[model samples]
Target chain A: MAEMVFQRTKGLQDRPFHYCPGCTHGIIHRLVAEVLEELGVLDKAIGVAPVGCSVFAYDYFNCDMQEAAHGRAPAVATGIKRVHPDKVVFTYQGDGDLASIGTAEIVHAAMRGEKITTIFVNNAIYGMTGGQMAPTTLVGQKATTSPFGRDKNHAGSPIRMSEMLATLEGPAYIERVTVTTPAHIRKAKKAIRKAFEAQIEGKGFTMIEVLSTCPTNWGMSPVEALRWLEENMIPYYPLGVYKASEEVK
Target chain B: MAKVLMKGNEAIGAAAIKAGCKFFFGYPITPQSELPEYMAREMPKAGATFLQAESEVAAINMVYGAAGAGARVMTSSSSPGISLKQEGISYIAGAELPCVIVNIIRGGPGLGGIQPAQSDYFQATKGGGHGDYKMVVLAPASVQELTDLLMEGFDIADQYRNPVMIIGDGMLGQMMEPVELREPKKRNLPPKDWATTGTGGRGHTNVINSLFIDPAECEKHNLKLKAKFDEMEKNEKKYEIYNCDNPDIIVAAYGTTSRIVKTAIDKCKDEGINVGLIRPISLWPFPYEVFEEYADRAKAFLSVEMSLGQMVEDVKLGVNGKKPVYFYGRTGGMVPVPDDIVAEIKKILGGAK
Candidate 1:
């Protein structure tokens, strides 16, 4: 007799992941997939994949998907959600896509209270573009573009996107969480589910920022990356509920 | 429908609604601000969605989203705003999504002025966005034509799975004219089986995207796009010939300037100087055949433009050295009157007739 303790979620397509080992994008993707399938909305889900590490997310998500231009996934999700209000629409974007180049789009989507959920992955560095300094890169974090270790005088400070977005009045739910440990991963998945639930109820805009790790760019081994994230990234980006409107609370 | 007096901007909005387009995403810009205002008030009544995007860039991208979901959608902006929308326009073209875009052009090398201009003639016809693509550019000389073009533009966009643009100027947008709005004709458009609506009823998941990372795969997509464009060029060429039976000179023009050229042709007739006009309705599917037909009959070809001779180059290419081509233009939101066009024609003719 054999027991199957782990298997791929039905929300995910039959394809090997392209993410590198220790890359938190794989964990984040699985959490989102599990959430979609558990909500029983996998067939009605349409995800907007950003131009970052998750750009090939369309090949991974079992449901319908759209690949948006650099930093424009929120605007694209807004369009999709407006046209098909019955369907569950969401965007998966990275630090460079959301905090920097796509600042206008995400802000406006939230301000308009668009019925779309956003999965914002803040890994503190540009993952797909080969270790470039991102808008969310920490003050002294080392990156290829920030070889001088991200001078505070020259490059300014890392953006606290979850906190900044929580200040807006439109969001129904907003939270920041990480996935370095079993407990943290459970909290992250719960936050993701709440964000999607807000969309399912046709409440308003919702977002979950996952403080992620870039093992290859951070020059850390898989285990070291997790330790580094726990020691450094967690303190920089505090994990907690930033906003929860009456509908989601 | 009975003819009703409507401003060009409002007429354009109504015309889009009549074309079965429910999703309208646009940002407010001068000369075209009334358009979004009109949609904001009217689209809701028709059970349509009207979104005033944060910027022109966001507006076009929103149009891209709705279009990808198989909803007929549209967006409008002025010159500078349209320039900002180019990136999304290129993506929309690349994905082979059908959507309508309206550009009520105003003066600009950079936010020059907001009165009226045909400066975007080159931008609209020569691919305003990056990459190898084209728009079915329709230049409407009057409010009536503005309304008609929008009604047909959406279908043409869906028919070829390409972006269709209606190019107007501030004059056409601001002026009030009588328009008989077409009945909401239900067109038998192709099923959007590939749209990212959902994978529920469909057996396989659908993907609506423009990302071709591999070079070879990207080229194959480009070739597919080229074939669609080739088909459009073959069947969609549109132009109107006015008083070209026997003439000493032919004036090539479009948009608001074309009407002035027509009035100038009347003035030339009164003076016993035979002049004619070749007004191109479709700017990208340019009617070069009209120029080739009258190439030898006319002594000279004159291009009357609101910008500094942008369309003259296309007129020259059309004439192909058969006749001498000349340009007469007014720049920076200046609208040329009939007398000005007539004067330019006489100068080129040099008392030949």
Candidate 2:
């Protein structure tokens, strides 16, 4: 008898996710699932799914999940974590959801030192809503809402979330990583794991902001999208640990 | 148990911590402002979360977030501040999340006053937000009861998977009295299997949500809520009957005003007039059955309030027009004294000097 080795993440069924082709959300989702599986905390964990392409994340993560109003995942996660501090709590949010609509919630959650992990995906442009410029959108990146390219004169510059959040002393750990290739994906996984580990260790507010590619929104092929993230987005975003106690030396 | 002098609002805050409610989100609002102030000092000692939210809206949503995660949570505000929380409260109710909301009500119709008033009776009883939802409304007439009811409010909220509201007047929130709190029971909430903890091999992710686009699905959810409410009405209706033995008149009141009415009933009895007091503990079910029973025996009923006739209408309906229900209230931050209520009770008794 052949060893049966095929199963989608236990909580996430095998349905095709709603993310656009070449969008890195699916990869991030898989990474999160793998971490949950590896830690043996899947049944004891709960994820707050954000509104965006990842709105259907509840269907993909086998653990108990909840959908938050746009950008309010952090606040919701705070609630869930406080009620069941023994349970691991996390929120999956997009650039628009976290940086735009959910700005106050995430900031206050961090300020309060909530013992939760946040997986913030910074894809430069809004993927689910069709190519609109996001708070994290690069200055020269042309989005549907910024057809003339993002103008610093009017639209303001891209927000460096990790840098800004790092300035605050609330978070126990903060890091930025990319998922452009297999090696980068491996590194991204390590950072993601570290963020969750911080939460498990009773550290407060660890966030891993993944610099991802939105091929459909950027009007590029998957290859070009990855290349574009490397050439343009990474230069502005700078993939590395902006703040971590281990990196203090 | 020995009684200790305590303000109603302060007692609620202490009782909540004793009840294992470790998270409290609130903004400063008059009358009930002491609640958050108390929690700010108490929560840290208990290893709890106490945050002064940017606004009442944010505070309530914070409670919503925490409660959704299956944590024991609470919030307190005055009438105007509670008005700001209506949106979040509606969302909480729609999602059937368990939590506690305390409204130390003031005169209202809009920023009416900072003094005590029962003007929010309609809002508390009839779902204060834009949905067909009901909160288990608990009205406390004394500081001791406020402490006890707040603990009960948390249990009932968790039991029914809905928000429970403790509605009091400003006087109830500010006034002090001796109270003896019972030892809290251990919280036995089943592991929040549905909370958004990282999935540890659970068959499916549990989702807490209020959005249902499909009409049939929405209707089904509404019916489930209605069934729970019907059960609550049958099992959770609570009221206290005082001097009901062969009384000529019954006075319907609650919260701070009820205590005043008690004093007035004593005065009326001294003057050779018989007046009974029906004080509702669970105000949402409104103790209609009790009113119906009293209506058959009494000559007339008078609804005493600190606001303009809000609960009087409910009393009239509860009596089903069997007796004339008259309303006498002092609005805009004014708390009518026992003498004022006694005068009204005498007038209703028709020239009983």
Per-residue lDDT tens digits for candidate 1, residues A1-249, read: 899999999989999999999898989999999999999999999999999899999999999998899989999998998899999999999999999999999998998889899999999999998999998888888899999899999999888988888888898999999999899999999999999998899889999999889999999898998898888888988889999998678
**Cα deviation of B157 in candidate 2 (Å)?**
1.9
CA deviation > 4 Å runs, candidate 1: B183-188, B351-353
Which portions of model 2 show Cα errors greater than 4 Å?
Answer: A1-11, A83-87, A123-159, A178-184, A211-239, A246-249, B25-27, B40-71, B107-113, B183-206, B211-213, B243-249, B267-274, B298-300, B342-353
lDDT of 2 at B318: 90
Clashes per model (N, Cα, C within 3 A): 0, 21
What is the total number of backbone clashes in candidate 2?
A: 21
Report lDDT per candidate: 0.91, 0.85
lDDT of 2 by residue, B76-151 (tens): 9999999988978888888888899999988777877888888888888887898899989999888888998899
What TM-score would candidate 1 get against the native?
0.98
- Poorest 10 consecutive residues by lDDT, candidate 1 chain A: A229-238
